[model samples]
Target: MTTWDLAVVGCGPAGSATAMGALRVDPTLRVVLLDRAEFPRDKACGDGIAPQVVDLLEDAGVRGVVDGHVPVPRLRLDRGAFGVDRTMARPAWVIPRTVFDQRLVEAAQAAGATLRRHRVRELAQPSSVVLDGEVEARTVVGADGAYSTVRRALGLMPGPMAVALRGYAPTPANRANAQVIAFGTAGQPAYAWSFDRGDGLANVGYGELLGHRHDRPTKAQLRERLDVLLPGASDGGTGWKGHQLPLSSGRWRPPTGRILLAGDAAGLVNPMTGEGIYYAVATGFAAGRAAAEALIAGAPASAGARYARATRRLLAGHLRHVAAAAGLSRHHRVIDAGLRASAADQRVFDDLVELGLARGRITPTMARGLARELAGAARRRPVRRRR
Candidate 1:
């Protein structure tokens, strides 16, 4: 039983990022990276990296991997009678998870973290993780996504979860490089997307509130809608995959235990956008920093609590706004009106950016302006027309 200083379960962006962060913070620290699957494994995702995530990775020295992929620019938002193409001046990258996850793991390995491809069976307190009949590590990190084993071991399961379906399609030569979000295609409250990855291929998928199924299309059915939406890229067959996202921030209580959680294991994904890569990587970096501080300086083991507090400071307002935006989208009419309004003016895009900066969520300030406009319209309601 070679007791290690830290054992990280799951080698996705979150796990690898955390390992890299911890090692960078302390090169001498012994960190073991473990994943149930082998390298180049696939995870269901839209595969589009927003600009914010790109910046974070660059600061973390992983920008090369992100830059190597194709750049995506505009995000086309749509609903039944509403459609808008919002320009993203900052480039977005589209990369296959198989390549991206492996690259991150390799980077972590280069940073002095040992890598292991063993399935983690169980996790125990007071420094121990059971993987392949062996108990290893003085500390364990749960980066294993929504159905997180580390979280389970620590009695920190997510109370609410979201189900998502994703896949890839062939991109036509004529189509523009853009990320498309279509709502009300098959029903209300559910939406599908098509992301041009710039390799004569695109990523297409759909997600809906769990248990809120209507006459909407299933993951497979969305393929037909994809064909209707983008005829040029619809000739190829469909590829379908599914995954789960946890909504709650998981348990941050007693953050000073022998086992810690980060990324999806901690339910750190954005509640509205279904975006988790940046948040996961960010959380991973923070967790690694906290772990390193605990190990090198023998600081109060409550470093994870500090990390959680920092996460809230950085993301709570944005997440709350996400929740509010998601609520608004639940209404088909609102979705239609929002998209239609955005298409009419680039100001909508500017407002969205400002709102995200102001409150942390991707909200369009145009909505508030539109409300004011409506109020003004009511004020001039022909005062002499009293019947």
Candidate 2:
């Protein structure tokens, strides 16, 4: 078996991005990407790509394919009777995972990484992977998602996680270019979403943290909510599908030995919004760079440590905030109040959205606004004297 410099398991955004990032740094590095599914395979997702994701895709040499996506210039947030609609300064795009993932796979191949369609069954010592046979690699990256065989092979148990179900409905003529997110009812700690694919179809779904104390919404409940929000959309639950999201809780432990994990395999999804693509690409790039550097330096053992440090540096603060938000979301009434406040205050709305997207941090001004809002609510409460 030909020993390769890197073997990336899973060819989704993370795996492909790892291969592409590695080869871009050193074209001579031999990289092989393996996946059980072939290109153009559908994956259950929200199908919404943020602006930062576009930047990553462009850097990976897949910008041309993005033109096929539907431009989403506006975002709508709804919580009970309060709602806010705002135009994104940088527009996002809606594209099916089948189409989007294939482009990334093609880009990885174009970057000189070999693509193999095989299911990885086991992991061997000294950075080797076993499939139909043993293939030695100087380093290995686990980009496989939530139910990552690679992560389990490394004996890493994930912390808190989420389960999401999404399906497509015919897009309403009036909502062709808008994206909508609706917060779940009190105590649910989840949200439902609808993204207009601009191809006469809208992606609608709901997600909740696994093991949450509150009851998880059923497909029927999700359908009913979609009907209320989009009216006549998703009325019959035609094509609903479910997937797992391994949320980051800021307690990540690096995989034992030399194996490196990135993307969902490492539980890198944003807890606040269940967004995985951006983190996948970011961590995949970091893993690739770290692996390439370690391989060139003849220090495979250092790869895990280096990758861990890089991930901490990149995601520690964001993960902390997201974890906090996830915890607070358990009290849905607080979230509802926050949403109402956001609807009434533009700065509050931007800050809240930015934090949810991991685009920016909470500023002092936003904090002050929140404090004032809380104080006012307290004053409005009728004083009750001890009887």
Candidate 3:
């Protein structure tokens, strides 16, 4: 019958960060972190950790979490005969989720949050937030990823999804020490990537948006496409696993109660590049802070409103811009234009990375570089707005 200040479901990046954020706000507040699985468990992901994610973890008081992992400074994008290879402004690390998630959970525990091994089957707000009628808290943050129980409990509509298959293999010599994305011919927004882990191996994967004509790639076909896209890249690969990405195609408005959703549960994955760690940590922290503020103000039911406002300020505009970008990306020529532009100007490359990785909006420079191609890419007449 112990009531807690906050209960966070899911001990992945988002959940751990949520606990850390709440504890940072008021170290004395009681926070419980729960996950169905144990630490060091493998998750099916590209495992590309943006440096921006590291910055956020540092803010959450976990520094050097990616220590000893090699920094991958170069990113390459290719489709058909067009390609762009360049060094990014900031380096990124490729660490398997097995190591990464465990470290974040440890940091949260170190920051005075309790970690529990329990599956949360139900949530109720009849009084304080209650999980499975046993664990009670003033507020709850849901960070349980794409197949989110909290989102289902709240009766929220699931967002758009992209499925990706991931595996580990020895780094191909030509693509070693780099992160390479090869746009697939099967469909728009489909690509295969090989990211060097700096230990003679690379994390390789292929992903494509669902609800498209090319959505139905069987497991063997997915692997076949990977082999064709990057020859020799998948050689001697192991542990191939696939997962769904809940894309942040639109804004997520939390209900007016003590429950809030973060990370993939909120559909916070980046639409342009399928990156979610940054969004996960950022929204998790915001949700945690919002819950903390509501709890401290003695208006726990207001947690959702506080979270909605915070995320609106943080993601609304960015989501809109990325939506526009994603629409244009439906055509392959647009992808070619982006690659060509990035090759010609380092500023364009930096801008594209920023837009894909962090809370970056489309810039005039980006628009100027790709606008004409975009118009011609579709080869369609513009619709005039009604007067």
Candidate 4:
């Protein structure tokens, strides 16, 4: 019966970041974070934390999120015989979600948001948002990740899904400070990553987009794909886990009610790279800020639309651009050409990183470069990589 200003489900990065964003704005707004699990819990993820996430955390008043983690400054993209090794525009930290999520939750609590270890089984909004008929809030943020329960309550289906298997192992000697990506053959559903966590371990995984004319792979098949794509990397790996990512597409529209979806719940994962942390933090923060403003204005129901506009302005045509890029990448030789172009130019590589990890769009310069590389790549045979 007691209503709070904001209630966020799922106290992961997205939910905690939402609380931080709201409290950072007003600090007095009654915000509650509800989650099914306790702190220091494991999450299935590639565990690559982009510097852009650091920026968002800083804005949310949570610093040192990845402070002690090792940073990977270089990115290497490879395909059957074509490859590119380039320095990232900024370094990325590889921190397992267990540490990262807990820190964010603690930061949110420190910012005056209440944390409750309660699982939100159902959500209903007649006038005010209610969770399981126990928790009530003027506005709700569904940061519950892929296959979100709150999202289902909003009468929406999740977008396309990509499944990946992740585990950690001793860092390969040859890739000490680099995040390596092995692209699947063009037009095929295959890609694998080995990101150094800078602690002698590398987070390794393989994934593919689903519902784009491909069947979802089983766990055994996912591990098999990892073996084929990044051989010898998965050996002796520990704590192997599989999770689904809801890929972002331009088709996403905001809810028409007081509920706003953020993070994986909104399908904000980068279609091109399966990256969601950045989008999760950014959108969650945006939603929290928008919800705070709406509550302050005595129009909490307007939070969804306000959050939508805020994301549109924040993402700035990136959603459409990445959707198109992912489409083009399905064609033969597109990945090869992209790697070739990125290898030849730093600007292109930087652009690629921005597109995958943050809100970056296709650029004219990148287009010209890709076209040139495509033309050149056609004349040569792809070099086969050693398993």
Q: Which candidate is the best by lDDT?
A: 3
- By the TM-score metric, which is better: model 3 or model 4? 4
* Local distance difference test values of all predictions, in order: 0.70, 0.79, 0.88, 0.87
* Model 4: residue 25 alpha-carbon error in angstroms: 1.6
User: Which tens-of-lDDT digit does each residue in 77-180 have in candidate 2?
Assistant: 88777777877777788888998898888888988999888788887774354544666787889998888988988788887778788898877665678988
After superposition, candidate 3 runs with Cα above 4 Å error: 212-216, 372-387
Q: 360, model 2: CA deviation in Å?
A: 2.8
Specify the poorest-scoring 10-residue window by lDDT in model 1. 354-363
Give the residue spans of candidate 4 off by over 4 A: 212-214, 378-387
Top candidate, metric TM-score: 4
TM-score-based ranking: 4, 3, 2, 1
Task: Please give, for residues 1-387, the per-residue lDDT of candidate 1 as tens digits.
Answer: 677777889999889988988888889989999888978889898887767766666787775787567788777776655577777657677888998888889889988999888778665554344545574665567899988877776766574566666767776554458877766555435666777888877887766656533433465555555555555444564567877777643223325555678878988665556778877787787777767766776653555666667667766776666666667666655565556556666776655543332235554467664454445545756678668
- How does model 2 score by TM-score? 0.91
| Model 2 collision count | 0
**Tens-digit lDDT string for candidate 4 (146-184):** 979998887788777888899898888877899999988
